[model samples]
Target: MFHRYLNKVAVVTGGSKGIGRGIVKVFVENGAKVVFCARGAAEGEALQAELNQSAAGSCSFLSCDVSQEEDIKRLIAHTVTLHGHIDCLVNNAGWHPPHKATDDTTADEFRDLLNLNLVSYFLASKYALPYLRQRHGNIINISSLVGTIGQKDAATYVATKGAILSMTKAMAVDESRYYVRVNSISPGNVMSPLWLDLAAQTGAAAEAIKAGESNQLMGRMGTEDECGLAALYLASEATFCTGVDLLLSGGAELNYGFKSQICS
Candidate 1:
């Protein structure tokens, strides 16, 4: 087992499933004691147990609804109380609601998404910064490829993700004095439960999935494990990296025109 992160302590939000879960798994596999949380207790507990069985490090689960300020605060405080220090803070808790045009999206929906997808990141970092400063730890915010290049009919989701990227840069600057790095990963077409759900939402699920796969120049969607590896790189290596938005898009944004036109 790799001991790259042995004895390190990491706090991951929304780690019960999807990309967040992948990040937690990678950290534990690399020997980082991880404290992860999600809104679903059953899933979180199951993941905690599964990882602890064979992980080089160890992990624990906490029930947290990241949309709530208290929950974010409690998650960070509980991790520090349990481990005494934080080596990494992965603000991965977020959601991408069904696609909606700007005219169709309600103000309340936008605000709700902001609270869950953007504000939670801020609150988690605000609470974890003190502990991270002591250990010179870093932060990895899970953003989206759409955040950089806009997505059609997904204005609300894009807004939140774009904000996260900006916030990551600002925080990176502010935290440099304490040696606490901040970075973001903008993933494109990652095949996770969330992505599957989004695909299924379309009337033609199979076609939607195929189109998503074709969007990437690689002609396939990315995997959760890939996201995990990227997070590991940011946390364990990439020492000189801060205020950077790493794109995990499988080269989806490389060319300008339709995939058929570009490839053909």
Candidate 2:
């Protein structure tokens, strides 16, 4: 176990599974005390027990629905109470709904996505900034590659992610005075449970998976561990980085036209 984050405290949202879980594990393995939350108590508690037993750092879990403002507020308060200060706030909670065309999407659906994907980040940052400023800590927002590069029939999801990138830059500018850095990660296609579930929704999971793999220049999907390592870099090592959108696309956006069949 590394001691880079030996005495730090980090709070990760939606940390029971997928990318959030990966981030939590990375932080704990690096020796940072972590307070992670998820709506499912079973998974959250199980992860807490498993990590505390095997990881170099300690971890605790809480039941939280990031869609609600009260839950975010409570989460921040509880973390400060337990750890006295927050060294990092990782906003990793959010959903990517099934593809839907603009004509089929409704106002309520858009608002709901905004509340879950965008507003929650804002609320968490707002509540955690005071403690973060005190510790000169940073905020790592989990955005998506599709936010910059458009996706098919996923306007709402894309909108939220794009907004997150913009918001991260604005927050960085405003929070610079406090010495609190703010940055974001835009992952292209990571092989997580959430990604698989979305792929299955297409009715041809295997084909969708293949296409996803082909979309990246590496001819494969990224792993949760990769995302975790990127977050670790931003939080611990990239001292000069702020308002930067670190793209984890595996060269997916390099050359236009069509994916190189030769490489595949």
Candidate 3:
């Protein structure tokens, strides 16, 4: 019912999997040509091939490390050269290191987390503004519920997400004069491949998933597509909305016991 993006060109960072991939799928299904970038060449190529075969939406994958300025510039240049103009930008690429307290986190790890989670968004927006300004496009940043309510043992992640919220607000106000809308979507726990990767690292995937599900009043973690829909709404139909943070946390932020939601 909401295929309003037909013929538009979009750029989605970290679109090879997880929430990013879900957003790409929705945009493509809605008739948008997508240029999605990820560091994984194999997954990127596979997704591109699948989209081409499905005839859902024309798509291409470019390898990019969003933390790097040169790579982000290259990504934007490539997309502009390929698609001519960008109608939307989705900053969905991010990383969450294992739960670690501030005291336990090394200086380097904290910096690395910020670089990946926060700096990437800034870099992407910096390079994408020219094209976005030309089209009066929109930017949708994928934030997190943790940004609103702090999570225990996730100080670095929470800090970065909080910064993202601030950045979205500041940028929205700064870009409104140009008719470009900027916003953010903060999603709660969602089941995605990232969980599997987390499991492989921490050896607590099954237990973690079970605990994550029970924390929500819905007794379930949200789906990636749910988050995607939130992003699509802000990036497309919400023309009157800017500097808004759409929280898709499924009531997880509501008042409750001060306890670890990750291991209910």
Model 3 ranges off by over 4 Å: 199-202, 258-264
Which pairs clash inside model 2? none
Tens-digit per-residue lDDT, 1-264, candidate 3? 557678889999999998998888888877789999999899998988888777546889999999888999999999999989998999999998877777888999989989999998999998999899999999999988889988778888899999999999999999998999999999888888886676666787788788788778888988877877787778778989999999887788887666655764
Worst 10 residues of 3 by lDDT: 255-264
Q: What is the C-alpha RMSD of each candidate to the true structure, in Å?
A: 2.9, 3.2, 2.6
In order, what lDDT does every prediction score? 0.92, 0.93, 0.88
Give the winner by lDDT: 1 or 3.
Answer: 1
Q: Which stretches of candidate 1 lie over 4 Å from their true place?
A: 259-264
Better of 2 and 3 by lDDT: 2
Best-fitting candidate, scored by lDDT: 2
Each prediction's TM-score against the native? 0.96, 0.96, 0.94
Worst 10 residues of 2 by lDDT: 255-264
lDDT, residue 151, candidate 1? 87
Question: What is the per-residue lDDT of model 2 for residues 167-207, given as tens digits with 9 covering 90 to 100?
Answer: 99999999999999999999999988899999999999999
Error of 2 at 168 (Å): 0.3
